[model samples]
Target: MKYLLNSNNNILNKLKTKNTLLAFDLDGTLSPLVDDPSNAYIPDTTKCLLAKINKFKKYKVAIITGRSIASTKKILGELPLTIIGNHGLESFYAKIEEKEKWKKRCLILSSNLKDIFDQNEFFIENKKYSVSVHFIKKNRSNSTIKKLANTIKPLLVKNEAIILGKNVVNILPSNKSNKGFALKQIMKKYNLHQALFVGDDNTDESIFEIKKKDIIKIKIGMSRNSSATFYLKNQKEINSLLKLLNDVQTQGINFLCMNMD
Candidate 1:
């Protein structure tokens, strides 16, 4: 993949005239991932850029993430965009549910699996919303997670469930509830000609690979291999890119309106 300078002003110019959408991954692309994922926020530069981008009536911006919707709205606050949460398993327009009652919509992983969370010592550190069974944990065997998966498979066989493996095992809803699916939904809903997706994690690669010929796929963080069309060093670089896009959008709008007069 090429590491393009954040100077995609030409792309923004094209987007100004056509139906376009911007989608972002929350944890690492939009904000640096901290020890606690719920603490992530839109960087100042990103917020400024998004504000500018939102000015275009035809341009739709959305934040797609693996975090729950309530978790996202808490830290992200009210941004001028839509948010696809829990890897697209849950979504909210804005203020649909009070914060306290929002946690009820998470993908209903089998209640039988609740016992697995108790049997493992590492999982004890996990809280209610976030839990991962790390197969590679030291002193623990890899088969532990597999056995757990095997046990849960029967219970979820009738429901929508899938086993996704990364740093650990995740039993997520098997519906079309992924970043890629969410992006497509946004494009169709808005009738966009093209879209841009930026992300920086294993789960994000699911969307990165699905970028159409016209869409731009950007990856953050250092990695030799990725399906991303472009690469940035980290969230700071992503912030810089957002700032540049904001400036371009401001200039593009002024240029467009001036010609209309």
Candidate 2:
């Protein structure tokens, strides 16, 4: 992936377009990854930049995350932006019955999976529509975690899907909905044609796969063979990127006004 710097004139030119959608992954993109997910919050500087962008008529901002809608809303605390949660299964404006159905299945799976591994070996997080088996806190060996995943993988039924990330395994309904689908839906709803998407993990890969010429895909940190076209050195760089976006939008608006004059 190419390093995204302010000197990249080509990218800066593309970002200046009106009707652009600015999408971000919440946990590792907008907020630093915390040991406890409940404590995550958007940095004040970044939040201010996002608020400014949201106020622009020609620009739209959104948060797309694997978090549940209610959880994301609670942390964000009232923002004029679209939120796509549960890896795209839940949204700010729509209620999905499938989420409730998946919650039941996840509970059952969590109970059965717990039987195979020692209860203290890992922690289970039930996110209503999805379940996450977290091995991070336990400090289990990599091989041990792999073995546990292998044992649980076979137990998944046809309608269930599993994705591995960092030291966690997430089980969710195997539906057509994902970050890519959610991004497309949001763009379509707003009649937007250009988008800048920033994310940090494998879950964000789906959004990177969207084959749109105007889509700017930015990965938060380094990864092997990431599909994103650009990379930010780390989460700390997210603030810099947001500031640049804010500057670009301000420039765009000033240019429009100058043209009118």
Candidate 3:
């Protein structure tokens, strides 16, 4: 995989129009992963760059994450971008009743799972339409984690979908909603011709599944087997990527203005 900064020029050359969508995952992509999810925040520099990118009318930005919409909004504060939260189950277009139903189901599942797994061993995050089982704080051995996973696998066979991430397992509703579906919905809604997606987790695989020549899929870490077309070394490199994108957009706009003259 090529470095995103090195390939900036080539990527910019391909996406010269305003009809491009810039979508990002929240936790590991925008904000660094932390022990406590609530402590995550977008760096000031990245925030400023995103603001500049949002200023261009030709470009659209979005945040798609496993986080609930309310929590996502609270963390990011006020940003001029679309947000698809709860893994696309709690978006602007989602129905209120549908969300509530999912929430109820997740609650039931969480309660049932709590009986099998000790509450102190793992942290459970109850979102609007899903639940996240975080094991980072547990400090369990790999073999123990595997055993736990095997034990819980059978319990989630009915009406629940599971996604594995870094030290976490997300139990979402067994529905068609996901990050890829959300990306397609956003692209179709805005009539975008291309998109650039950056993420770092198993959940992000859904977005990578989209088979489109115009889409730029970037993974945050160096994973040889990742579905992403490109990979960044770590989360710190995200600032550089954002800066490059801003510079490219500025250059594109200036070039367009020069042509108009």
lDDT measured at residue 45 in model 3 versus the true structure, 0 to 100: 75
RMSD (CA, Å), candidate 1 to true, equals 7.2
Winner of 1 and 3 under TM-score? 3
| Candidates in descending TM-score order | 3, 2, 1
Number of the top TM-score candidate = 3
**Better by lDDT, candidate 2 or 1:** 2
RMSD of each: 7.2, 5.1, 4.9
Count of backbone clashes for each model?
0, 0, 0
lDDT digits (tens) for residues 25-64 of candidate 2: 9988888888767788987777787787788776789998
- Measured against the true structure, the TM-scores of the candidates, in listed sequence, are 0.72, 0.87, 0.89
lDDT of each: 0.61, 0.77, 0.79
Model 3 lDDT per residue over 91-202, tens place = 8767888888887888887888777677786877888588888884744464655566676678765666777777777788765778999999999999998999999987
Badly placed stretches (over 4 Å) of model 3 are 7-9, 138-147, 157-159, 252-261
By lDDT, the best candidate is 3
